[model samples]
Target: MKLYEFERAPNPRRVRFFIAEKGIDLASIERIQIDIGGGENRAAEFRQMNPMGTVPVLELDDGTALSETMAICRYFEGNHPEPALLGQSVIEQATIEMWNRRMEFNLLLPVAMAFRHTTGHFSDRENVFPDYGSDCGQSAQRMFDFLNDHLADNDYIAGRQFSVADITAVVSIDFARVIKMRLDPDKHARLIDWHERISARPAASV
Candidate 1:
């Protein structure tokens, strides 16, 4: 397997962390750089693999490419089920997916909008200029409060066991900090504790 990775990007870091948590010795996996600023991922050759021209694309052994960080992480879990990052039972799977979707929609998407509009990071690809910065920031903060409340009695997002939902939440929350947004530590003690625990995981640095 080959992973098209970018060192500084949080999207790719999510996938890298999943790979590490799974204990998949992909040391032999090839890594292709997709420099976002240099337009490397936008090249014609790379675009053929994924029309979106994104990083963290996983090219399987048979040469099939998987795009999207969550999709790639789920695929890895499916292929290597020992670690079981998604879930084992049907109900568990559904619940995990539910939280994962909520995290993406409520937190991750807003952070992306905030960063793109406020920082104009991808202005070249699409016009962005603080068009929705305020709304995005508000949405992120709202989601943070929601998640903080939800996680008050749980060790992880979905339940006591760790799952993909936690991965999504952690990445989204960390990414949202770019907009100076976060769950209030004073009001969200459990959420803050969860973040600290996840951050201390060795795979977190992967």
Candidate 2:
């Protein structure tokens, strides 16, 4: 398998972190670095593999390519199920999926939209809808508050155990920094504590 990725990109980092948690042998898989800022992902050759031209594409040995971080992670979890990042039971799996989707939509998407709309970083590369920037930032903050309250009682995003929900939350929280959305120590003590604990994990460094 070949993983085409860009270092420091939030989505790709999710896969790297997931792979690390699964104790996957990096040597067994080929790693291809794509220059996202340089628009290499937009090139025709790369676009052939993924029409969306997104990073963190996993190309299987059979020449099939998988896009989207969560889908790729699901594939990995299916093949390597011992660590069980998804969940063990039916209820647990459903809960993890619920929380994961919530984090992606309520937290991650808003933060990303805010950054893309407000910052000039991708102004030349993609369309910038500045009119929605404020709304997006506000939505992200609302989700942060929601998560902070939830974290007050629970250690992880889903519930008791660390799951893919936690991974999504951690990545979203860190990525939110680009839009200047952060966990206020006074307002989100529990969230901050959770973040600190997740950050200390070995997979986080990956």
Candidate 3:
């Protein structure tokens, strides 16, 4: 299998982190670098793999390509079952999925939209709407407050164990810094603690 990704990209980082957690042999999978800034993803050959022209694409040996971070992570989970990131049972899987979706929508998407719309990073390649950028940043801030409150009680985002939900949350929270949205130590002590614990994990360094 081959993974198309860009270093430092939040979405691709999610997949890299997942692969690391699963203890997958790095030698077994081929890694292809995509230069988003240089318009590499927009190229015709890359677009043929993913119409959205996005990174973190997993191309199977059969020549099938899978896009989207969570989707690619799901594929990895199914193939490498040990150290399960999703969950052991049906209920656990559902719970983890719930939290993952919540974090993706409430935190990740807003933070990304804010950066893409406000920053000059995508100005020449994509449409930039400043009005929506401001709104998205405000939305992400609200999510941070909500997550901080939730983390005050639970050690992990989904519940007791560290799951994919935690991965999604950590990546999103860290990536939000690109838009100048960050956790306030005084206001988000629990969240900060959780972040620190997760950051110390070996997979996080991947």
CA lDDT of each prediction against the hidden true structure: 0.84, 0.90, 0.91
**11-129 in candidate 1: lDDT tens per residue?**
89888888889997657678877888988899998899899998889998898999999889889888889788888899988888887788778878888889889888887888886
- Candidate 2, residues 1-206, lDDT tens digits: the string is 99999987889989988988999976688889999889999999999999999999999999999999999999999999979999999999999999999989998888888888988577878888887977899999988889889987898999999998888889988988877787898899889999999999999987
In candidate 3, what are the lDDT values of residues 71-127, reduced to their tens digit?
Answer: 999888998898999999999999999999999999889989999988858898888
Local error of candidate 1 at 53, Å? 1.0
- Predicted structure 3, TM vs. truth: 0.96
Candidate 1 residues lying further than 4 Å off, grouped into runs, are none
- True-structure lDDT of candidate 1: 0.84
Top candidate by lDDT: 3
TM-score of candidate 2 against the unseen true structure: 0.96
Clashes of 2: 0
Cα TM-score per model: 0.93, 0.96, 0.96
Error of 2 at 7 (Å): 1.0
Q: List the residue pairs that clash in candidate 3.
A: none
- Candidate RMSDs in Å, in order, are 1.5, 1.2, 1.2
